[model samples]
Target: MADAADGARTPAARLRALLAAAPADGPVLAPGAYDALSARLVADAGFSCVYMTGFGTTASLIGQPDIGLLGAAEMADNARRIAAVIGDVPLIADADTGYGNALNVARTVDTYERAGVAGIQLEDQVTPKRCGHMGGKEVISTAEMAGKIRAACEARRDPDTVIIARTDAVATDGVDEALDRARAYRDAGADVLFVEAPTGEADIEKIAGALAGGTPLLFNWAEGGRTPPLTLPRLRELGFSLVLYPIGTLLAATAGVRSLLETLRRDGTPAAALGSPQQMTLPGFDEFTELVGLSAIREREARYS
Candidate 1:
């Protein structure tokens, strides 16, 4: 029997349920989180799910771009940490190129499954894959990517853990070929299809129309990237089952930190920065402490004493 302390459903189960129900209602809007704090905020704001973005994770962890700088271990470790804090909220993580080939893809899936992610997204770009929105991207052959997708599906212990197959062929190949690659991945047992960096509305519709039949489609709402921004309803109308805002919070935090630092440098204090309502209004110190579960820690400490 399962432990009484454990919830009735595992995180994977919950995420699967969410994905299954998404098509009927609308797209599942998952905002990306770079760290535990950001994930907590995302959950606190009442989002049903979170996406662990590799781009934002690279920037947050090492202050680097998403040019495949992170290894499988680093990405898995980051997912584990974020999963620890977000409670029951589902995390859909980016697994870039599955680190290597078919065997590597299996290991990547296993690591992410153990790390408590509900979904893992693997792209078709080469081992050292660049960001989907970036230029000069190249993808592996269709058969090779299909093999990795099959490997990913075979490796996951949970049947409910979703495997997303992202094809970056829209830039290297065209939208039509990207759609063809998506079909191959779908046939290989990918739970979701992501045709990355679709340039315009027509391409987006084409992707949705071609692949959104039995398999769910994922739309990358990468702000200021190659893809044009569309509203959630518009994306839903386009038949996308999941929409990921991969760096909205990260970008906001970047701008906020810069503003605060500039204010502090100019005034020799942060008070002026905090005074404006238009400026970032941070939670009070005590509230932030509570947000981080200081009260729970104190209660446990008292019980021990």
Candidate 2:
């Protein structure tokens, strides 16, 4: 499961496997990882795939929200690092609005394909991203998003590289419009349908059935997003193949860092309560001997020979 050398195995291959395995299973979990270390941790924890979260990356890197602060270059570098440490785990990325118009989407598809993402979820929210299930959401015309979808489909080098179309129309237009957009995107060659923020179970069931067993489905489990919370089993029963728990890691890490800082400030000494002497856990010390063990072994062999 950890090998990255098999020519026949690709991120797209892993994604297809998940699509095939979705039926009659718990919702496929794609926890968001902000950086290389977290990606490795997630892969090692036995997740089938990892999500390169935009919100986490932005806030952790520059202390900002998903308000479209990180540009294409930053996102690309982050994705490259994430792909590297996670080995060959399928990465489902957040390509927020393809980072621009249709032409930009075309380039994005090519770039992300080269970056080795198994699939990408493209939203219709006009740039300066608003949460998919949140208030004050703006959406592009169905025709425009449809055009972008077509561009992405055509730009990809691998046919199996999934193109997921996500719409914020549910809040802006209504369930009917969102469903309409999903149908149109499906017709435009999208592999998966993401009618984001369906308000209730009824609409969720409606969307699940609307695909007519054609393409796969995706959902976001944003804690405060417009969509009502549901259990993993419930989401699976509703026929969703992929679920993204984005921002959870960043939120947890933010909370922990703040707590540690508060403890240090209040006690005037974090060393006594948290880490070793001076409460800094050796503060910035990294033990490298274990990391270089293989290098040491190689050097020893050369010396001996």
Candidate 3:
């Protein structure tokens, strides 16, 4: 039902609808996107939620990794642009490590709330973040992360804006330690729990089963981050509220673009691409031309008046 004219609609209303319309008895599939066009594509694909992946944003925008390079302002600016086009669809943004400590988390929450994200995931990795489920992964004391969780809870303007506390201590420390931190984080008022990078099936089961009772959970389906990938149904069976396919869109786009470039090199043009505007049907082109004609009529009327 969405169209170009619907651009002026507020994000909150659309977001609410998306949240309400998610599969009633099953886990939702949320895909990650970095920019506005990708966000729109995700929405158009009938995805109920769109995740603003930190990795994708870093790599796509600045050609970097999930390190601490992108600052709050830069991330917020990018979020605003994506949220602008996606019309809410419940954006679950990746606020990696809060960009700093507890004090920084307060500011991060304030700014992200203003950017109109529906939720945020804050991790326990002590700043200067390394990928979770990877070596050299370090975590702050549970007390420190709890303080940041509290800060995040206090900072949110909307009660519905979920704060997901991600504990990276599973890889850094023992599972017991990570569980301890998750308990403290939940007690500190996180709406969801993201226990990061649980490697094997047993670990995944332990994490999922342990958190299934009272808290909602999120699972990452990254290709090679630290954990193994599972199909959507498997994730749902494990009691995950959302499964984020963070890099699949980007990977597909990257491959397509690469192929297009190679084709252009070999041939004279990217001629076989059906996705191009050149492939539009006659009626489709006519409808597009009609819109232009309507716009020109409005412009002429405005000029005379």
- lDDT of every model, 2 decimals: 0.89, 0.80, 0.77
TM-score of each: 0.95, 0.86, 0.83
* Model 3: ten consecutive residues of lowest lDDT: 1-10
lDDT of 2: 0.80
> Tens-digit lDDT track for model 3 on 222-290?
766778887777776887876778887888888878877887788876555434575632235556555
Off by over 4 Å in 3: 1-24, 272-305
Candidate with the greatest lDDT versus the true structure: 1
lDDT winner, 2 or 3: 2
**lDDT tens digits, residues 1-305, model 1?**
12221343877777666666676678888999999899999988988889999999999999999999999999999999999999888899999999998999999999999999999999999869888999989889999999999999999899989999999999998999998999999999999999999999888888888886789899999989989899888887887888999999999999989989998999999887667555547666777899999999999999999
Task: List the candidate numbers ranked by TM-score, top first.
Answer: 1, 2, 3
110 Cα displacement, candidate 2 (Å): 1.1
Per-residue error for 249 in candidate 1, Å, reads: 0.7
